[model samples]
Target chain A: MSFEKVEHALHKRRKSRNIGLGAVLIGFVALVFVLTIAKVVDEGDAQRAEQALRINPPKASE
Target chain B: MSDASLNTTTQDGDAGFGDFFALLKPRVMSLVVFTALVGLLAAPVPVNPIVAFASILFIAVGGGASGALNMWWDADIDRIMKRTQSRPIPAGRLSEGDALGLGATLSVFAVVMLFLASNIVAAGLLAFTIFFYVVIYTMWLKRWTPQNIVIGGAAGAFPPMIGWAVATGGISIESVLMFTIVFMWTPPHFWALALFMKSDYRDAGVPMLTVTHGRTSTRKHILVYTLLLAPIAIGTAFTSIGGPVYLAAAVVLNALFIKGAITIWRRDETQAEADGYRTEKRFFALSLVYLFAHFLAILAEAGLGQFGLGGWA
Candidate 1:
């Protein structure tokens, strides 16, 4: 190939498998949304568990 | 530039998806992820599982961003160095501008995502780590000073602390100790490699410890840093993330590390070269294992802590 053609090819050839990169970016976005929900759910669970512990006084004796 | 036979695209350009990914330095990113995971898991507070996952992922991304930017900036020196000549930027698979763009994008993305997933503190620390690595270390200190790795080591040391912040939403002694462990470990670990690979830094004009101070000074520094590292390594056993399992592991590891350092300190370059730098090479390899084992032991202690059977009184 000619020199200029090779230079053009160099840049063009770099990202052929960008499908996988796209998928990963999508996955990252999905994970962020999932984590927001998980935090809410986990907080709710913690509150319920705290209430239960208070009522039951579930402490181990030293 | 002397070897006549190797000519493909004239070492100029052309690469695929793998080249871009290679620019991220996945190996270093994995270490960042592992240490950050241990820090998160070992924290006293519980994090939402998905949040924890996201936080670690962002931290990895941030670390990768640092690597990419470093590669972009260091491409010139990298091309001259045998050890680093094949990196994406240096190998001409990716342009320096492309690396800089990707790294900047990832740095912002990771930090913002971390803030969304965890807390501002974690995200802030991640941003700082990335900046310190790319700007302070790669762009500035690396060429200017021999002690580049010492202060620059803070960038690598921040992940666990960032992980701690992800879980607890704050820093504490435990997280600080984790940060310090990696920080103290960096000088000796890198200088050991410097002992054997001084030629690379010399040729690259990168001002590594060996290039500036000579092998003898580097050796002494390694032994001194190892001595400084031992107490910290063993002392972590009494911390929240440590237990008998950790103490035992650390004791054995540190003893062997000290032995290795002493041997390296005692050896002259002639002796080292005569044996093909075997002692230095062995020490360098062991340093990797040593750091990983320490982190793994901390993780083990965390598992035991979960069972109410860990930590010293």
Candidate 2:
């Protein structure tokens, strides 16, 4: 007896949909990671700038 | 039925990824993306590149969510209308329940992500835009009133405003003008479409201007709205966002748009039917170009200003 399974078009379509969804999810995760990194870096820069101003405050009348 | 036959039947009704994507109304989403991007770019405040990109994506997803909700709500009419007959719900590739779930989920996701990426104001505007499009426009205004498109157009006009908020964290005259430009442009644009897309809205039983009022009234309405749109489109030139490039483009485009409206207004049914709505169709095509070119000119002006030549001092 042959032991082969027939692949239906429905299976292919479902598979494609699953892959598309998987790709979207992965892409979303990567985006969030990048966004978080960018936000953290931005806040850090702002904090550093604030500190620098405190340490070497500008003269009132230049 | 044999298994093979059953499989064939099942596959025929099965939806692919693209079918699901169609639920988002990608074409409309393109307009949302472009206008929103322009708003973000043209703002006086400089957004971090990453924040800008993320905010735009969330705005687009929010726009798409509303579209899906619209498709869900209007599935019946969509099935009747020739233009929208091939949408996923009408085509039986996706169910209304599927659309509802996707739309609801994405709406929340987009709003929350936008808040995290940008500020509360931008996120709030995005949320309000979604609510306006899905509930106010789709559920209440669309089928109930002839003024549907006029009011519903507000939902579309919000994206650029949201984009500006992303950069500036507040609304300004520039953003308001951007909003008004789109708000005024929508009626004439859609009315011209209704002129050419004869009997589609009528057959669908949607209270489009053509259905509620006769074709003659719709034509007259288009002329009036186009006339109103002209000053706003041209006047935006003097705003902080506008410059010489925008002014020149606006002058030419508005002249052409008004000329098209007059031609449309003058024509009777016999003349339009004889030429298969050539003038109306041409007018419709020009309307699309008119809006895009105006926005492009604004973008061009902003770009030039970056290099010390954009807006008038």
Candidate 3:
């Protein structure tokens, strides 16, 4: 291949690679969103558990 | 205007203190410092403030030393990798010999200073962390196996445990859990970067997951490791160091981490390539926040406990 053609091919490959990386970045943002939702849900459970523990301490067998 | 001017310009092109410092990988060092500080703060034993500061400083120095040594050894391959091409040694700004000398000096200084500031066990762990990163991980595993990051992750995990030892004078389940969180987190985190930087690793002849096993397999491994990391991270909440703050962070971060992995797994190479590896880059960035958030949560819990308001206590 000519020098210009080789350079063009390399540039194309780099561009494609950059695009691939961008897709991954979008996916990561979506994942972060999902996890944030999950944490909100879990926080509710933690609060409930705290309330339960406070209201009814474990029975003792002295 | 003369030959002397030319010589001066050539000398200026060579690396000085700033270049050598970059080789120490300050960003990685910061993460090490943050996690180690969390470990120290979360320990049940009360350490003197001065000693605690000194010990953590030594640990950070130890981490930097490890980075420098890694750069020294990996300079050859680094020159071939585009992502690492501008690094000090690889860019011809700093000599490999200088890196070795600096790394060796810092290694001794960090370890000996840690010994003075803390107990023998903490100091020993710091020494071993440096050895593992430099000799075992960098020298042997990085070139020899695809599981390099998996096994080598232990070196990064040791800082927190060492920090814990610095305060408590021994290891505990809590410290081990902190160690496990980072250890489990490393593979998925690094694999995401590997997926996008596949060509660089291939060019450098480094057997990263994407280069050796292929991108599909690398994505699957990332998903698998992230799945494993979720439980380990959440489970920390049941430990002494865990509280509402950490539990909240873990639950949120792990969910996001897993979702990210799954998205990456689902995408075809063409689609991902079209998107400029967006998912991959996001995963790598999130991985950074994941670790920092977890440690920050631990620190928050410790602070709350000090104020007599923590549920974990």
lDDT of each: 0.88, 0.91, 0.84
What is the C-alpha lDDT profile of model 2 across B186-282, one tens digit per residue?
Answer: 9988988888898899998889988888889989999999999999999999999999999999999999999999999999989999999999999
lDDT of 1 by residue, B1-313 (tens): 2222234452333467777789889999999999999999999998777788888988999999999999888888889999998887777667988888889999999999899888899999999999899889888898999999999999999999999999989999999999999999999989988888868999988889898888999999999999999999999998888889999999999999999999999999999999999999999999999999999999988888778877775
Task: Categorize the docking of model 1.
Answer: acceptable
TM-score per prediction, in order, is: 0.89, 0.97, 0.81
- Candidate 2 accuracy as TM-score: 0.97
Return the candidate ranking by DockQ, descending.
2, 1, 3
Instruction: Identify the leading candidate in terms of lDDT.
Output: 2
lDDT score, candidate 2? 0.91
Best by DockQ: 2
| Docking model 3 quality class | incorrect
Tens-place lDDT digits, model 3, residues B147-187: 99999999999989998999899999999999999999999
| DockQ of all candidate complexes | 0.33, 0.62, 0.02
On DockQ, the stronger of 1 and 2 is 2
Worst 10 residues of 3 chain B by lDDT: B4-13
